[model samples]
Target: MILLRLTWLSLLNRKATLLLILASISISVFLLLAVDMVRHQVKDSFSSTVSGTDLVVGARSGQINLLLYSVFRIGNATNNISWQSYQEISKHPKVDWSIPLSLGDSHKGYRVLGTSQTYFTHYRYGKKQNLDFAKGKPFAGLFDVVLGAEVAKALNYKLGDSIVIAHGMGNAALVEHGDKPFVVSGILKPTGTPVDRTLHVSLEAIEAIHVDWKAGTKIPGLNISAEQALGMDLKPKQITAFMLGLKSRLSVFHLQRSINNYRSEPLQAILPGLALQELWQMFSLAEKALMFVSALVALSSFIGLLALMLTSLNERRREMAILRSVGARPMHILLLLVIESSLLTCLSVLFGVALLYLSLGTLSPWIQSEWGFRLIVQPLTLWQWQLLGILMLAGSCVGVIPGIRAYKQSLIDGMAIRL
Candidate 1:
């Protein structure tokens, strides 16, 4: 108890410098933990968005492009699959369920996904699962809207509210769908995928809104009422892509090959898991860059802590003389310094974690609203915890230099050392 109090007093005496050290270490720990968590999660998020699905089939493109456009809503699809091709694949014997998707538009920066009700009933993310509705029911009729959890919360949308859709694949200058508006039919539970930020409506809704348009612009002076739209056949001509689940997992490669060599128009089929792996490989470079940058920041912080303690040691020489005369051993003095530093490091790590979670909890709604990215404050994984422990140990070890110097100075000066 006496020794612990001595260590406490020593750090308390230099409160200003110690506080700076604490702040630096805290920022470093926070950044290290945050970067590690984000790198793992972004990849996990991308891969988890569509699991248990055998393949994602779309018009001819690279595997990475197909996955990004269909699953992540990252980029627009270069070509769309005809509705006839979707039906033909659905008829295959090994197929269990197929969800067709129509893309190529946005509303206030939110992705507009035109899909059948099976998307809510059968589509899964993270694990093999179905869409969970947080409020209201799924789309029931043409022009009905189903907001993602993020979309609903961010936009403050609820059931029966009306909203206008925008034209084009991005934040465009004009409101093309202003002539036609949609009623909020439902809001989905949070799934933490692109789905959470997407706006889901029926394929018929896609057809109805786009019937008179060509090449992403309205055919001039060609306007029709919602009633007239309802009267026309609402079938889709071209869909951006489709997801396929197989009755037999073993037949995935065979199905992929079949789709790749379709009779008339060329098509490409990508295994969701395989395509996800490819996508991750492409993104790994960015992850490495972030990790490297965060590591350098941590290194600088630890060095700052070391420099502060060493510089402050000069003022403590007389204090050390007093302690040596009072019968404190060299090891005891060394341990006092180590305990102070280790405790400070541990506190910084804990405080940093708290601050990170607090920030995320507060800003999560805003981030999802504007960025279409969900930030999850998950506890450190085992490996991540281990990495942090190693950093803490390294920081503490670096702190030992001051303790060693203090021990030597106390022994050599024999109660006469003066700063």
Candidate 2:
């Protein structure tokens, strides 16, 4: 009871100082956890984009460029592997199935991926998961197009709705495929992958739309209508790249090496996961800088807590003397001070966690749309708890400096009040 009474009295005596302590802890905890959550989300987004695929084969280029262009749809390919080349590679005896990808097109900033039905079956993102239909089924015909969750919601597209593709990478409004509109056939569930920001169509549909087109021009006014193109053979002449799955999981390394050594061209096959790691290596410095900033913010907040505690130590001496006169030992005084510090740190963590949760709850949609990655917020894992626990322990040590000063002041000015 005395300890409880002492603790309350100590806090009440200097409410302003304690409030400062609370606020400092709150900010530090918030900074640390926020950095952690975002970093985790970044990695999660990368790994979830593509997984379990054996190889990504494409025209002559570095492994990094192919992954960026085909998988992430981040840039345009310098050259295309002829669809004939893709067919030949797909027919290799060791190959299981392959999905051709045609890029350099968009629908209102979202990527347009020309692939086969095998894509829906083979593509897995985030935990080896297959795409689930949020609404409607997979495309069944050539003109039937599938929308990703973000693409459908952002554009307000539904089954049977028509959307026209543009002939560029981004938000440019020129070169619209106004002549060839696609009917929305399926909408995929939100997977938080690049698929969430992509439109899926048949390779034949891609070929059909550009059949009479040449290099950003309409073939000198010999325009082809959608209906007429359908009647014409729609075999793609060239493709950006193709994703390959091997016949056996064990043969992936061997096959990737084989494709990398293909005789006809300087084609490259990359392991998707490894390519991503190499890609992220480019961001290593930035990530490290982020960590450093987070650490600095957290450290500054903790120092603010320490300063507040030290500033209040002089005023707290009298309170400590009274407690000691009334049978509370110096050790009791020490525990009280330590307890206050611990309580402040605990409240800060709780408030920080609460703030993170509340913010994520509101910001999830904006994060998914603007960043193409979902900011998944959940309970702290054991590792996070361990990190937080360490923070608390370190904080308690910082409190000792103030606690020692209070003890010495109380002993020197026994039974006397001094500011």
Candidate 3:
């Protein structure tokens, strides 16, 4: 108890230097915890991007490539599957539901998706959560469109507003289907997935807009008015991919095998969950790199604490001599320094935790609105608790070096000081 009191008094006497050290340690702790939290949350978000779907079927391509273009809207498909293949496979007895996706169009940098009402009814994300409307209902007409939350907010669109889609994926598309403008019929709530950046339209609408185009350009001397195109056959001939939900979980592998062996055209079927795991594996190196960098920042802060104590040791020779005259032993001085380090570490951790929660609370809504993922605020996870324990142990160990030096100096100074 006496040693602890002496340690406290000594820290108070050097409060300015101690506070600076405390701030540095606290900020380091914040960075480490924040990085860890984001890493885990991002993985969870990615895994939950599409659920309740057993298989994603597309033309033969790399598993990761198909998954990226189909689920994440990250890239273009290598080839498109025939609409006839989709019908034959989706009718399989083992398949419960399927959602067709037709890509290759964009509206102001956001990808446009051509799908059916089945998409609105069967699509899910984040724990089997269904898509819900923020304003209006699903598209009921050929020229109607539904906007994702981010697309609506970013473009300032509302129900009944007209928007033209470009022929390709680029923002500055040279060829646009301006004649067949789509009216916004619905706006979906924030879903915290790639779905938030997409524009949904009926498959027929996709076919109608391209009726007058050939080979990625307008056909010479051909002009199909929107009303005239609506009267013509608009059945889609090909689609980028389709998602399937099985009637029975046991039938997933059977259906996957059958799709892969289809006799008509080359095709590939992938389990969404397994594909996601493979995708995460590709990114594991970057995640580890980030964690290592944050850890180094924390270690550097502890080194700063060590330097502070060692530099202050020479100036405290007179104080040590006074302690010796008051019957304080060398062991007591060593223990005092260690206790001071432990206290600083604990205080800094507490401050860091407080700051982390405050930042999450303030920024979570904006993050969800802008980036399409929620930052859930919860108690420290078990891994975080273990990390704190390791930090405390490390801090105490750091103090040992300066403590030994102080112990030896106290012995040399003895009970009297010449100064």
Candidate 4:
């Protein structure tokens, strides 16, 4: 109890230097905790991007490629599946429901997905959570569109607003479908996935926009009005990809195999869960790299604490003489230094934890709005508690160096000071 009181008083005496060291250690702790939290949250977000869909079927291509374009909206499809092929497989005995996706257009910088109303009913994300509207209802008209939360917020769009989609997948497109403008019929609530960044439209709307175009360009002297195009057939001939929910979990593999071996068209079907696992494997190295960097930061802060103690020891020689004159033993001085170091570490950890939660509370909403994923405020995980324990042990070990120095110096400089 005496040593602890003395340590606290000593730390308070050198407030400036000690506070600086405290800030450094606290910052390191914050980085370590933040990295772990983000890694897990990002993995959860990726895994739950689309749920309840057993298989994602697309034209013959790499599983990663199909998953990327179909679910993540990351890349363009290599080939589109014929509409006939979709119908044939969707009617399979095991298939319960299907959501067809037609990509290849953009509104501003966000991807425009052409899908059926079945998409709104069948698509699931984040533990089978259904899509909900933040503003209005789903599109009913051929020229109606529904905006994702991010798209609406970023573009400041509201219900009944008109927007034109551009050909291809970029913000800067040479051709715009200006003739057929779409009204904002709805805006979906944020799902913390790529769904938040997409604009939804009917599959027929995709075909209607290109009715007068041939070979990716509008035919010369052939301009089709939106009304005239609406009267013509708008059934999609092909689609980028489709997702399927099976009637039973047991039939998922069997149906996937059947679709992959379909004789009419070359197609590939992937289990969304397995494909997501593979995607995470590719990014595991990057996650480890981040953890490594955070560990180094923490290590450097401990090194700084060691240096502070060692440098302060010399100035405390007179103080040590006073204690020895009062019959203090070398072991007491050693234990004092250890207790002081432990106190510093504990206080730094407390400050770090407080800062971390404060920052999360302040920035969580902004992060969700900007990045589309909620920064979940959860209790420190067991692994995180273990990490804190390790940090405390490391800090205590660092004190041993200065403790040994003080122990040896007390013997030689008993009741005498060279200065």
**TM-score, every prediction:** 0.93, 0.94, 0.93, 0.94
lDDT of each: 0.84, 0.83, 0.91, 0.91
Per-residue CA lDDT of model 1 for 1-419, tens digit only, reads: 88778878888878887888788878887888888876776677676788778889999978888888899898878788889989999889999999999987777788899999788777888778778888898899898999988878777889999988887766658556877799999999888788988999999999899888988778999998788999999889989999998998999898889999998688999987877777777878988898888889888888888888788778888788889889988888788788877878888888888877887788776776666566787777898788779877977797699999988887788778844
What TM-score, to 2 decimals, does candidate 4 have?
0.94
Superposition TM-score, candidate 1 onto the true structure: 0.93
Residue 24 of model 1, lDDT score: 83
- Residue 344 lDDT, candidate 4, scale 0-100: 92
For model 2, give the 10-residue run with minimal summed lDDT: 410-419
Q: Report RMSD for candidate 2.
A: 2.0
Relative to the unseen true structure, what is the C-alpha lDDT of residue 260 in candidate 1, on a scale of 0 to 100?
96
Q: Judged by lDDT relative to the true structure, which candidate is superior, 1 or 3?
A: 3
Candidate 4 has its poorest 10 consecutive residues by lDDT at 167-176
Residues 174-208, model 4: lDDT tens digits: 58999899999999998988989999999999999
- Please, what are the lDDT tens digits per residue for candidate 3 over residues 1-419? 88878888999999999999999999899988999998898888888889999999999999999998999898899999999999999999998999999999999988999999999999999899999999999999999999998999988999999999998997673578899999999999988888989999999999999998887788999999998997898999999999999989998898899999999999999998899889888889998998899899999999999999899888888888888888889987788889989889999999988888998899987887656677889888999999989899999998899889989888777876544
